[model samples]
Structures are given as C-alpha cells and as structure tokens.
Target: MAIEWPTTQLEKQSDDPMVILNPKTWSHYHSYGGWGKFFDGLRERKLLATRCSNSDCGEKRLWLPPRCECPDCWHETQWVEAPQTGRIYTWSVVKYPGELFKLPAGTPLISVEIEGVCTKLMSFLKEGTPEIGMAVKAVFNVDNPTNSILDLAWVPA
Candidate 1:
C-alpha cells in the first residue's frame, strides 16, 4: 500500500481510552554538515569511510558511518574509500516496517562486515536471499539518488 497523508481533520477513534488520528504536515530543514560527503559519495557510487588523523590514536580501523571526530582521541577524521565487498554478518526480513519506511514490507535488512571497518554497516538487500557469511557487494542508487543511507544497498556477489 502506498503512503498517503491525511488532508482532513483529526479523526477520533476511541472515547474511553482517548485515541485520535492526528494529521501532521510540516517541512523540516536538515543539514548533514560534515557528513554531507557521505551522502555525496553515494551519488558518485563511492563508499566513504572515516579514519582518525591523529597518529597517536589507538584506533586505526576505518569507520563505515563516517565520523567528524575520532571517538578515541577526539581528533579530526579523514575520508577514505571503503571496501565495496563484504560478508553478511546477520540479517532479518522487515515484515512490518514503520510508516516512514520507503521500501515495502518483507525487505531483507542486513548487517555487513567489511574488512578494515571497525563496525558493521546496516543496509538492505537489493536482490536475492540473505544468509550468514554470504558474500555481498555495495550497490549505489546513483541514477536516482535519495541523498540518504537508503541510496546504498547490498546484493549477492
């Protein structure tokens, strides 16, 4: 089913419990700030990660969700190209997602474990079934970029 916004007034569903369906309509201005490069990389079909610039920092692994500062030393981070290939560490089918979820229900969500990355990147499977230890590659929605994390997906490699 397609998502539709309610244009009419709020509808009261119950009286004893007090429940109502309130229609909300508003525009929110948001900025990715230092993380804008991550979204831009998605459009360019590139996966960007962040690494601590401080030489003294103990953490040398790349961060998938690029950070503006290093968590260890609080130093500045540098952008680096991440490995496109990874293995599905875990997965589950989102049979009943929230209303704001753009994708349809039953979509397979996966946690990818890429080498050199310190953490698992959460993304959806674009095609094929997911399994533990399944090899996968990053696929970008460059043709129709959403400027969001949804623009990145994984497919069986």
Candidate 2:
C-alpha cells in the first residue's frame, strides 16, 4: 500500500500540546510557544527569534528553530522577529538520502550559521555549495497546502 500523509489546516490557539501521527513514518507534535507561534508567523513570510527573559542574564537566541533553552545562561526567553536574511555558518550536500519524508530525494539541506549569532540553523540549500559563513535566509513555501514543517524552508540570501 502507498504511504499516506495526513494534512490538517486548523488555526490551533490552545496551549495544549498537539500530536501528529504517521503510520508510514515517524510522528511529531505541533510544538509549543518556542516554535509554534514563530512558525505560524512564517506562514505570513516573517521570521522570529527567542531571547532570554532573565533580567540579570540577557542572552540572544539564534537560528529561530522550534526548540531552545539558554545554553550559556539558563533563563526564560521572549520572541523577536528577525530580518529575512542571514549568513551560513556551515552546510553539507545530502549524497545519501535518508528518512525525512518532507524533503525531496538527494536534496541538499544547508546548515546556516546566521551572522551576528553564535548558533547555526539547518535549511535546504536551493542553490550553491555547502560553504561556511555564506549568506542564507528562510524561504517559506506558501503554495503548499499542508500545514506541516516542510512548508517552511531555506534558500540562498
């Protein structure tokens, strides 16, 4: 039987965690605030970052991914929408395709380390080599009908 990928288009406003199951593949959750709200903003073609909330310890989060905790300083964080552009810290060509159903076969997922930040975020390299310290940015796929993580991706800046 062919694998099935369930798609849902709901505006989830609840704080409760949402679960997503796939019989053909691994399952994932809708995720909580650290990523959910930020991702939702991406649907509108915007990016956001998390910052430490501790008054004594002010830390800036990097590469606005779904999960984050203060690495240097353990502190609560807030959200900040970033510019749609950044630089690549490092990347690698996917010569051996593996398990992610969301990505196309043999596609390159570039790991970008945005400028002015100490962290690197992974994104699909639409064009060019897996160079370090190269410019890159988040490219949202709005045409996609599925409300999934694959909807948001990265490309050269």
The candidate maximizing TM-score is: 1
**Predicted candidate 1 versus true structure: per-residue lDDT over 42-147, tens digit per residue:** 9988999999999999876799899989999999999999999999999999988998999989999999999999999999999999999999999999988888
- Per-model TM-score, in order, reads 0.88, 0.65
Error of 2 at 61 (Å): 4.4
Write down the lDDT of every candidate, Cα atoms only.
Answer: 0.94, 0.64
The TM-score of candidate 2 is 0.65
Candidate achieving the largest lDDT: 1
Off by over 4 Å in 2: 1-30, 58-63, 66-75, 145-148
Q: Could you tell me how far off, in angstroms, the CA of residue 122 lies in candidate 1 after the best superposition? A: 0.1
The positional error of residue 77 in candidate 2, measured at the CA in angstroms, is: 1.4
- Each candidate: RMSD: 7.1, 12.7
lDDT of 2 by residue, 1-157 (tens): 9977866645555546864442455576744655677667767886667766666765555545633556657665676666667776666667667665566666776666665545566667766555667777778876653555566666666
Which pairs clash inside model 1?
Answer: none
